[model samples]
Target chain A: MGGDNAPSVVLEGVAAALEADPALKIVLCGPDEVVTPFAANHERCEAHVTTQVIDMGEHPARAVRQKKDSSIVVGCRLVKEGQAAGFFSAGSTGACLAAATLVVGRVKGVQRPALAMPLPAPSHPLLLCDVGANADCKPAYLVQFARMAGIYAERILGIPNPRIGLLNIGEEEEKGNDLAIKTHALMAKQVPGFAGNAEGRDILTGDFDVVVCDGFTGNVTLKTIEGTSKVLFKMVKEAMMSSAKAKIGALALKSELYELKDRMSADTYGGAPLLGCKGAVVVGHGSSNAKAVKNGILVTARAARENVSEIIAQTLAGSDASNSEQVE
Target chain B: MGGDNAPSVVLEGVAAALEADPALKIVLCGPDEVVTPFAANHERCEAHVTTQVIDMGEHPARAVRQKKDSSIVVGCRLVKEGQAAGFFSAGSTGACLAAATLVVGRVKGVQRPALAMPLPAPSHPLLLCDVGANADCKPAYLVQFARMAGIYAERILGIPNPRIGLLNIGEEEEKGNDLAIKTHALMAKQVPGFAGNAEGRDILTGDFDVVVCDGFTGNVTLKTIEGTSKVLFKMVKEAMMSSAKAKIGALALKSELYELKDRMSADTYGGAPLLGCKGAVVVGHGSSNAKAVKNGILVTARAARENVSEIIAQTLAGSDASNSEQVE
Candidate 1:
């Protein structure tokens, strides 16, 4: 509802999605007066006039009630009442997160939710979880993340035996703190199909399909990698602009340079899924534009059709060996 | 020295170092036969024949005694005895770290030694500490790392008021657990000019001059950044080579691309220093060639001239700041 550029970018995204899939359904969740004008210009959004506006400025969980007819509240209600499969937001992340947790709640046996995103590596993109969904974590939560991420990888990525690794300070089973040590033991014994300890570097190295970590470490690692990439690209840009020779050289290399830039764009990575939820919801980038939103919709649609949540439940409910294999 | 391309790379680095600096001196500490022959090839090496050959296969710390005659051990002895300003190794990190603590010893008030590296960024380089120095840590150790890293940024890079930051999982001052929270408190109380708490992305964002963390978290952050960069570079190369036009385009951009690669070279920032030691020490890349080795020596010489160790000690000695900034 209120991401970067807000209604304009989001409205364009909705249009793009409708163009690609004529039969696709959508329920916009934001201020009616603001969004109605954008929708009024669109011919495809016929007969779907539902007004429930959620203010981007409000604290999502608490102020959500204040805007009783807000878009987010309505969107969330649609999902809760079976009118929609899931909710998508490019608005206040806190609001989206609060809504996702409070509205849909957790699946049975899932203690905390994880935010999983595919790292755009040269190798097959690896899934790193707990980006910011949960701050404090227990060993059991990490183990469940491994199991959950593994199933998603197998179904979504089609990677056979999707190896699940617990992100730690080291590769040695006994090397990390009490949390890592306990998680390692549990992964080795209780969690079937565990791939053992994977260090931070291994996250993007693609040594494992899923890198499971507590929210604290996971969010830090994710941000570090992103920051590093930006700084490096900036360096390249500065170097290219430094001198006449370099500038001339950059002119000649602009295509290849941009080709590299496009590969690292956050938009290319569609969305960060709120994993282990009953519904199929995906969170697009806060700075998302038309293309990214379109991709987010498609991703969510696929997850819904694929019944990812159902698979997660069945996987967690199955036998030790079956669950273990399913975990990958 | 168990890093990628261990002995061979280490050998090339030594060769490079000896050739570059006329005032430079070295005390080789690996296997005498392995390091001596190469040492002999360089002209004016008549005064550089000292050697202590340590077994590569032996436990790094324990091997120090068995191969008391090894290069690492002997080199460490020289530093311990004040004959050399620093020890450089591209060999066993465990052995190097062990010998650094056991032989040279730590400065007063410094709990653990840290391996600090300067990662290439868009705006100047960023200094990250405790890359892989110690596994576990006390909040006190993190406090010490900030002081030591601050001194390093000052004398080496000449960045006055170097912004020292604690690499936490989150930017919120109150977000982390006992370790992060306690560390935050001490840093706020003790550090000279500290930047509250920085997230993982801040490192590459060039937001701070010195990024500090415990060995476990720091090591993970360091490696993950490296891996992500590697993967990203590879992706650019692959995209450039995917098609005929792209390949042709890449050829036009080859010079600029090479410039980018050179600017991003890990060794360009010199070597990772073993901070909080009695003397200056640098660890070149295990696979380093002549230039990296030479650069390491120059880095060590600069640190020695700047009295980096003494400044770090003084910083620790006057940690409460009641004594004010110590002048060594």
Candidate 2:
């Protein structure tokens, strides 16, 4: 019903996830015809039928409000009604984000929700927040992103006392525009995990566990890396085939190069988690293959099992209480 | 006097450029001691000794104002006084951009000056403008960047009817934040060469000849690519060395890999041009080697020789006149 290859890929992904973990169960929400055949083929699977389909091209918030019977909207409704612990989608990112925020609802005091992904880095993994969530953000929203991502990195990624970095054009506190300058000050004052500013180059160097930015910059940076990596590998392959001697050499090193490329691939991480929603919601790529889809479901399951949202809520409440005490 | 390995690298670069192009002449400006020996050695070289130096960490606009006799200031002053056709520096980018805009001055009617670089793509080169000149920009400024960069690709890169893409979070006219949405509408209506929207991933795909963005996004995008490439190569090398069999394979493909790396290197294009100023200004990496420095000088010479600034002025004037006529 959603994504490039909707029902088939989604069915395969759910089957794979169920097979991998016996403790997992999936509730497939789509049209009766689309979900019934798949549900009949698998045990511990339920088909929650919906009549409406939200096209990717539609405006997210408007569609979410008008099309209450769409797969995305109904799936989020299940989470809100306490029937499902999480929601997974390979559909329109905007629609998923909108449903997660509006239907599943935001945590109390959460200014903005974010989509966080782990970028493969040299030393270790770097978590980048707000990849395509809130494009335009205030200084306070970035600070909240730092707090939420900091908790996620510590609890989920198994990093202790994870250092948070504010992404900016330069490492200097005085550098960057008004938003960066103000956010730098707030994070330093409020966040104990704040290690200072992380420049664009710092993200791949693994200098910080988490880098927080406005969604627009984060989205652009994410796509730029993806585009460059693709073009770079293509260029290498073309150059290798240009000469007879090079082709022979490339054949010998094909396995090693493949391994390197595999390690760099975003599919290694499954999908990005849309954080700050009440329930776990992982959004996979629209062009996600079977492997990526399975991994996305697995990631969502882990987020729900670990009570990540509850921890985030507690952390925010604790910080708020401490601030009020200091004022008193 | 500027850059990380200044004086020596600068002197060696000047020598290399002079040797390559016998018709070219250089006026070396620095401290008397540093420039005297080099000036005496070269046949056509002249030294304009300056006593002051601007440290990389200093505020750019402040340094330009206070340190009038600094090498950066003195060099740009020469361009303003018509003593040099163009200016080249491997110094602090902010200092160079500041001096070029404030000293050499912006082209008449130009809202903002931009730093444009040709990214080596799979098909042809793509020009990304405003890499780090203005951090916060209005929609109008981005429009100007698209126009200036469009003309540059046509005149300098030899691309006819060069396609212009406005960098944003998405390709939709209604997509992106307020600024991007506004800019998209204006570019569609105002810019003749506009090719609609381009996402971050489109920059290296060689889809658009010119991709215009605010300085912050452009700067972050540029550095992200650089960082990713560096880390990627390092990862490949490390993976190759993990086992004896892989090491042997890597050895066979060593030459091919090196060739691939060379092709992706930014050094091929020399340096990025700080466009929209009255004089041609080329800014290179702070850690540039002698080869990169020499190439930077060569790029500056070409821009000056082609009278890039004059053409930009004429084109801008023509557009303004036509726009006013349409309004009437």
Candidate 3:
């Protein structure tokens, strides 16, 4: 009812997830026609019919407010009301983010929720936060983003003492504009695992476990990577097919190239979690296939099971306590 | 005597440029030992002995003022005094930018000079401005950057009626922060070929001929492209060589792959120009080879011969006249 493939991909994803985890229960929220038959077939599934659907083109905040009976809104509401442990969407990113923030609510002391996703790197995967959350951000907000992201990286990602780096123009302390300068100074003092500063190049180098920036920059970087990778792969394929000799070489290297491609694929990580929310909320690409949809639900469940939101809340509370004590 | 392989690479570049263009004259600025022998060997070469050197790590503005006898300062002074039509440096970017702004000076009515470089896109190459100058910028300054870069693309890059795009978080005019929103509004009104807003992914897709942004964002974007390309190439090579069959495939595809890599290489463009300056000042990478250095000189000479500085000054004057007329 939401994504490009809609009910078919969604149903397959739910079925796969339930099959993998015997104890898992799914409450599918969509039109009665789409959800009723699927729910009736699966013993562990429950159908919750919705009257409306939010189009991807509609304004996110307005759509969320007006379409209370929309699948996205109802799904998030279930989490808020304790009926569901988490909410997952392969729908509009803005709609999902809006619904998650407005319906599921945010963890207290979090200024804004951010979407954190793993970026493929040389040594290991790096977590990039605020991928498409708050476009305009204050220095204090970035400090909080770093703290929350660090906790998630540590608790959920199983990376103890995750190093946090401020995304900036240069690695030097005095290199960026007012906002970056202020954020760097605050992060150094406030965050325990602050790893100086990370330039854009450093983000994908696996130099730091967590990198934080304003949503605008983070979103731009994410898209740029996606676009570049697409073009690069296309160019490589075209080059390989340009001549018989190249085609032979390409065929020979097919298996190895496939492995590399798999490593860089976003589908491997499922979906980006809308962090700082009280309940786990994950948003996948609109064009997500069955595997991606299944992975999205799995990641969301992992985040919820580990109590990622609670860990972030406790970390923020500790920082607030320290700040108040310093004031006294 | 700048760059990683200074003196040797610089000398070879100068020799190559002279060999290619017999009419071209070079004024080599360095210490006596380095410049004297090189200048003595070439009929079109002149030597200007300098007493000091500016290390890449030195503070740019301070060193430029104190080390007036340094090659960077001396070379820029020649342009300022009308002894040379342009200055090219394969030295520290900060020093080159500082010297260009302080010595060569800015165009009339130009608030700040910017560094403009061509990024290799999927279609044709596109111009990106403010890559490393003016880190923090006002909306008006970005409008100026767009205007100047547009002219550069039309005149130098030979793209008539080049489309100008404001880089932002989203493609929507209303989808950005304070600076982006203001810049988009102004650009839509002011620029004749304004194509509205462009996202980060749009930059590499060859959607716009000239994309303008603040230096901080531009610099980060440039580095990210470089880093991503480097990693992508490595991954492809690794994949291709994973087995004997792949090795044969990689060999067959070698020539085609080289062509693709060449198209994306920064060295193909020679150097980035510090636009809005009174004189042509081109800055190359620190690790520039002999060919890159020669190309940098060739590019600087072309800009000077075309009187790009004069054209920019006149354009700025024209805009000022129109603004005043509207006010009246």
Local distance difference test, each candidate: 0.74, 0.86, 0.87
Residue A185's lDDT in candidate 2: 82
Candidate 2, residues A123-209, lDDT tens digits: the string is: 667889989998898887887889988888887777889999998988889989778888888888888789998888888887899
Q: What local lDDT score does residue B284 receive in model 3, on the 0 to 100 scale?
A: 90
Selected candidate, larger lDDT, 2 vs 3: 3
For candidate 2, the TM-score is 0.95
Ranking by DockQ: 3, 2, 1
Question: Which pairs of residues clash in candidate 3, taking residues 3 or more apart in a chain or in different chains?
Answer: A249-B249, A252-B246, A253-B246
Cα RMSD (Å) per model? 4.4, 2.7, 2.2
- lDDT tens digits, residues A220-262, model 3? 7888788788889999988888888787878888888888888
| Tens digits of per-residue lDDT for model 3, B1-328 | 8789998998999998888887788999999999999899898999999989999888899999999999999999999999999999999899999999999899998989999988888678789898989888888788889988988898877889998998898777888878888888888877789998888888888789998998988887888888788889988887776777777878888899999998888876678999999888999988888988998888888888889999989888888854342210
Error of 1 at A257 (Å): 4.7
Interface Cα RMSD in Å, per prediction: 2.6, 1.6, 1.2
* Model 1 quality (TM-score): 0.87
Better of 1 and 2 by TM-score: 2
Off by over 4 Å in 1: A37-70, A237-260, A319-328, B1-12, B15-20, B35-67, B176-178, B320-328
Question: What are the DockQ scores of the candidates, in order?
Answer: 0.46, 0.66, 0.76
In order, the TM-score of chain B in each prediction is 0.89, 0.95, 0.96
